[model samples]
Target: MNRKIVVPPILFIAFVGLIIFFIPMKEAFTFTEHRTENPKVYYLPLESERGFQIRYVHSIHLSDVFETYEVTANQKIQLLSMQYEDLAIGLPGSAEEGETFSFQDGLYTLTYEDNVIDSFVLLIGDVDADLAFRYLNKEINLKQQLERGKSYAFSVTKLSYYQMLRGGNLNDNRTKAA
Candidate 1:
């Protein structure tokens, strides 16, 4: 009935409520009914084979009329980036995702089914030495072919007008790879 008694209790409750709201509670980790029942389907790999993720391009798009895809080397590989027009026009291929096509940029080697898929797109604009895939992996550039599910890595600055060609990081000793 007194002001002090009622006021203190109310203030304490408000403070507790504010604290609970500010802090991130356990709801994020808690499993919901629907999520538990309907799990997303994922592709499984062979017992001995090691699969990489959709590496190569996280997401690629064309000017509007063309089609795009997020193809990876393996289950472990995920597309990192596409410098120019990631957009592509399908030339046609076998049942495998592998197909021949052209790229807006002059440089780059896209792999598929453990082989480098040759890509020779017409030069859209001025061909700059730096704007070529030769900067990434020489073996996987427009001239050469790349296989799908193979691991490859390189650091290149897309903004630069010219990029120097260099050796690629490949462990294939028997064959000459980038």
Candidate 2:
């Protein structure tokens, strides 16, 4: 056997195997299926036309990677309709007092008195839904039970901060102008 030929083939096979092991597989290649559960509730401190709109808290959840459900004060599940329209724009369905829209990736916007406020984009994914909901629910429930007035303390997870910082650069200029 020619040693040179044998060595080269062995090296090539090892190199290919290493590449396959190190390279991340695309989501399309993933065999696992994912479904988003109900969103965890969170208290969103909103400042709107209404004076100190803290009473209008929200318990938000994502139905999937794209869809969201906002439980309003009346306990109605309002779907947050998402549309690209050139950007990831979310329009809440029939928002009233104390409603919120949350993405699976942790981006959230609170709607109070027909105005959007306290928008924060968080780093979340299909796997983080349970954590997101738990966090949101804890905060919202605490705020509701304690009746914490304006300027209450809340935790913006590291994931949420990173997501917001990254998405901040991609905000729609048209919306800002309008």
Candidate 3:
């Protein structure tokens, strides 16, 4: 009933709440990199997706990805050695090139030619998720296909202009009013 007593505590609580609300949370932010045509990369944040795809072009896309099946699929699979430090990726087991394996939540038909297990589809679902690829006359050896790592040899938290504008506040489902 006393304004003097009640208002001061209410004001203090409101002030503390305001301070807490304004502070930026690390988990609230996400990052992604978009490879632009030029050296300047145009990065951005992602809202949501069930999954995504990856590709390897030219010769060696990254030092980690391959030009052929240099690391024997059998050997790696046998030894249980993942290609990368993260367990989210690895290669499939096969005795021949055209072997198809379920990789990264999608179907991957790979080719084991030119000393590399280089190209494959990055799928998003158990079925009907892979995008069509135009390999032309290239041999598609699915047997040597490997699950491409999430890092794609390297993953940086992407903050695009869109994400920078939103400041990670958009995706946060918390009821904290802005």
Candidate 4:
């Protein structure tokens, strides 16, 4: 059964398994926690200043809040700024059509322009509200990586080196609960 030595080793193992399942390996910033029984996922790697931030602690104006997202070159999620100190309720009470509200020293920014955002759901604040996720120097304390009150879902995906070696990096603690 030597058909030219098994057709060049089965076409070089199917061209290296189609370049390791279609090459992509990066461009992530995902987090999904669906929970009906179990469903949690996490990811990071989306650097080169694609920017990201999520600081939280405003359970009801307990102060400190800071949105600031930007993964845009097409991946969506714009929302440029939102530093709060109290604008009441869920915040944002002014600046809409191409936003811009300021307050300096005491804090109360807002500054947004396009505001794309394709995914976002957050709800991991049972009470201690310290939820965080900043990037570019890494600072992920999403209530110690999700599952407080649970309700996560954020996005900016693109992962593929076979889904980052079948685990999808939560700093490689090896995730499962799909």
Highest-scoring model, TM-score: 4
**lDDT of each residue in 1-178, candidate 4, tens digit only:** 6799899989999999989786876788877676555454577768778877888887776888988888887788988888887889889868878899989898889898777868888777678768788787667676665667778688888877776555346555434333
| Model 3 Cα shift for residue 11 (angstroms) | 0.7
C-alpha lDDT values of all predictions: 0.27, 0.30, 0.29, 0.76
TM-score of 1: 0.18
Which parts of model 2 have CA positions greater than 4 angstroms off? 28-120, 123-178
Q: Per-residue lDDT for 1-178 in model 1, tens only?
A: 5988899999999998867655532110000112224321111112222221222321234221222222233322223222333324442222335433344444333334333222212221222221112211222222122222232232111211111112222222322222
State which candidate, 1 or 4, has the greater lDDT: 4
Instruction: Select the stronger candidate by TM-score from 1 and 2.
Output: 2
* lDDT by residue (tens digit), candidate 3, 21-130: 65532221122212323221211122232122222321222223222222232211011111211122344444254333333533233442333222222322222222
In candidate 3, stretches whose alpha carbon ends up further than 4 angstroms from where it belongs are: 26-29, 32-165, 168-178
Quote the RMSD, in angstroms, for model 1.
19.8
Q: By descending lDDT, how would the candidates be arranged?
A: 4, 2, 3, 1
Clashing pairs in 2: 39-61, 40-133, 41-136, 41-137, 42-136, 105-124, 106-122, 122-160
Point to the candidate with the largest lDDT. 4
